[model samples]
Target: MPQSNTPVRDRLEEILARLDARRDRERAYVKLYTESARAEADAADRRRQGGATLGPLDGKVVSIKDLFDVAGEPTLAGSIIRRNAPPATKDALVVKRLRDAGAVILGKTHMTEFAFTAVGLNPHYPVPGNATDENLIPGGSSSGAGVSAVEDTCDIAIGSDTGGSIRIPAALNGIVGFKPTASRIPLDGAFPLSPSLDSVGPLARTVTDCMLADAVMAGDPMASVVARPIAGLRIGVPQGRLLNDLAPEIAKAFADSLDRLARAGARIIDCRIDDLMERLWGATRIGSIAGLEASRIHADWLSDDAALADERVKGPLRRRLAVPDEAVAALLETRRALAVEMDERLSPYDLLALPTTPIAAVPIASVETDANEYDRVEGLLLRNCQVANQFDLTAITLPMPGQTRPAGLMLMGRNGADRMVMEAALSLEALLRNS
Candidate 1:
């Protein structure tokens, strides 16, 4: 394994120090489980000092989503509904993988309730402020995961993306966020919101960090992705409606990104995706499979105290229950058809590129309380990302260079094309930086 000159303790301590500085009223973590984290890090350093080194992530700290099972820690899933649920009997599969790789578990990060809403707003717990601007909403469900990664609270922050939860926050917060093909990373012990679309991935400072985290979560040995130039890449962009709603700043950044890639010898093709809105609706319609499953898991709690749940959360969940069986079946069929079409359309190129979100981060306070605005902004926030989940594709959102407000350039690929997607992403990363 490659070794670093920096001491493990010093590196881990630097990340933890940033976490300490973030202590405040609007912090996301309700209970950090800091004692357990410190113990794990200390043990890792001691093992290293004793000349018994382990995996590549020997002392790296990763933040777990509140939804994952951490031995002896309650799996809140970002709601009070399961507050009384018993402590997890064991760490979830991903957690086990992290442990096996010698990564220190740095406690839980807050998220949208039941991981449903894209906007990162939870009335019950403090919302983590977007790193770039305190006033901006950390595009979420996986809100804190992105913030923690960007703020250096952890080397990697794990999150589940159903409809852009992972990519959204990463875009707003200015970091690399990846949503692998749903089955690429196991979700055995994580809470489910949309079974069909739900996928576990990470938000990190660099694509290299995401690569490392991806390997650990998948129970594979760590490996490095040698950065390649963007020369000869066939980059596709869906024109018309998909690119219509972007803000002026996002449009400029995207155009600049294209110019850089083209200069690097990439062929930028204007691709058109028909029935995109229908596909988006179908994906969202089928998304209720999770709510149905989750509702079953929380049936007792919902019946016993539905009123105690966050009102905003109840709206999304209740809507799922109201969806007719026939409608769901129809949506499932639509999903199958769309998936087939996506594969045919995307197979010709190595990857497709677009603006990650139609707009940049919205004001945090407004997102927290205004349901109508939240729905609109959240839809816009997730528009581009939903396409990947809709067709079961893998995608990465890289923060484009330049621009103070923060925006992302999305690179997408067919389902199960994770390695190819990563290769394209690393190439684009270099192109954007050197441009």
Candidate 2:
């Protein structure tokens, strides 16, 4: 059992002080469980004094995305529409797991309404500003989770990534985000963006922190993860669509990361998987499983005459309703076939690396004012990460080294190969930090 010299109550008080100082400016938390967290920390302190600790995360404060149920609270999913919804009778399975492991719940964080867009602008709640620059948009859906982690308000922030939500915010905020295979963690009470793609994961300061949170969520024993050496590791870089149209800063950071890995004796291969890319893109264009499922989830709410939901969410759902059943069936088939082909193509390599986002964080004012720019930037941000979700793969975004603006180097692996991706990320993280 690992122990911290700092008392849990003391740590919680320190975090509360920081939260108090920044609350008006950051707007990171939607609901602060200050009273409950204090109680938990005092309990942890008693256990510590008795020489008994819960686990690795005992006394650690963590934030949950508003998408998850928290017993008596109405799971907001960052929407005013859900304000009248009934309270959850029990904790979400993931929340219960975290509590059982001795993690203090620090309250829910804000997100894009229904986790709809890649750009994290909430018309209802105050949108959390980017951790690096207040002017920039904090990457979507998991916006507050990333902000909270980056701001040191919590040890970990649990968020759901359906289409780059977790990784996007993490990248823009210069922290580590991991999206595990959908099945690795149960989604019993998580509000769905796309049941097919929604995955519960963590955004944290280090790869090891993510691994610990992931283990607790997955109901697995926390195990020491040894980093796989970068030497002799086969890493592939997709050449065509993924690498196209990279912003100068993003390109430079990505290229520099590749150079470091190559110098470390890793085999960096230029892979051309245009057919798979085409298939994936086709499915996205035709109709998303996310959009289809979202339509179904909100059908009753959308049916009301009053404008209850945001247009950004309503517009997509309305479009999804027009999509024929045949089109959805065809898209599912295409998605399945492409997943198989993509796995086979990537089997030879330990991981595939790409620029997490083609562009860096855009100014919040720019996107909020210009709808066209918002659409273009949102599509680009979700482009690379969408492939991993559609292909049912595990992926991670690691912050690149020595850049004025934060950029991320993404490593994606096969569906069940989460540990492999984490190990590789650990090694890569070391390289980035040392460089």
Candidate 3:
């Protein structure tokens, strides 16, 4: 809902200045495209001054997660092992699209090594602490993406969501994060985490920015997305363990949001897909869709004793590499069936709603000191949002209204229902803000 009239060059300089002033900027960005960014910003400024702006994204300050390729640079993907890897021959497809649309690239932000972890800790890089609090976890593997999305230096931070990489950080940082249908945005040239689950999305302070970035990256014709009317809107709240173990604040915030929507004449129905979810989980018991595919993607390194690689990433992937080939086949077959069933179940509603994370950001010290504590925290954070990735649905996370610490209210739609999900989120964002 907020707009800035500052020139793109000025904005870029201010961000660059702030980076120069701060010693901890490595926590947010692994690289900064200083010269090229300035050039682009100046061009954007010239266009604005001449009334020939490219489109909504023109002149917008944007940041990409480290997994994406820039011409002639190896995408480190938040790990040191790749420093010796050959530089990319060309820009990643999404990067090319963003650049073509006139977005000023601010360089690559930090992420979990290989985007394997969900709670933001990467032994390989400096922690990009939570935006609101220094001690709390920033949420991973798009940890920097989350922090950058909230920081004024970046207007939109692009991140990949295999299993909540985008939404988790966005929720923790209290920004809007959109994860579209898996095939909605092309993934060429981006480092692979899980080919089956990987998706590219944008995190911003407003739904409109997310919609705009998504459109450009998706190569859809530029168009405006109006907020759908809440009156008679059908929102389905999944009734099950997804709503369990609410941090008192998260529970109250979710309940209050549902109440507000109901008061606004939106019909909130209790939707059940517990069986479908359980079956999906059961099938993946051989291995998760991500870990299994990632093992193959990183097979070359899995055999090496690379000390710099985060075991958190390599360890699980190593284990998944051992899963029987037949099991992998069965998992994929079952997943396809369940995805179709889940779609039918959710067809009656405009969107499926729930808390993005079961808990808000937790103390980094606690998670870092204890292995058990880290696993517990990561599971809870990834639990709610992973459903969308696993079940072939698209989702968005909006900052929960009136929360002391940041949290998110997620609305998921049937797979390929990206526009519907964005529209509902736009309307819901307004309702929550006004209330």
Considering every candidate listed, which one attains the maximal lDDT? 3
- Tell me which residue pairs clash in candidate 3: none
Q: How many backbone clashes does candidate 2 have?
A: 0
Tens-digit lDDT track for model 1 on 227-334? 656788888888877798789999999999998888879899988885755664646654455465455455555544436777666655665665666766677677
Q: Write the per-residue lDDT of candidate 3 for residues 323-422, one digit (tens) a residue.
A: 9888898898899899989988987998888999999999899998798999999999999999999988899999987888999999999989999789
- lDDT assessment of candidate 2: 0.89
TM-score: the better of candidates 1 and 3: 3
Residue 253 error for model 3, in Å?
Answer: 0.4
lDDT of each: 0.80, 0.89, 0.91
lDDT over C-alpha atoms for residue 399 of model 2: 94
Query: What is the TM-score of each predicted model, taking all chains together?
Result: 0.92, 0.97, 0.98
Q: What's the true lDDT of residue 81 in model 1? A: 68
Highest TM-score against the true fold, candidate = 3
lDDT of 2 at 391: 87
Better of 2 and 3 by TM-score: 3
Better of 1 and 2 by TM-score: 2
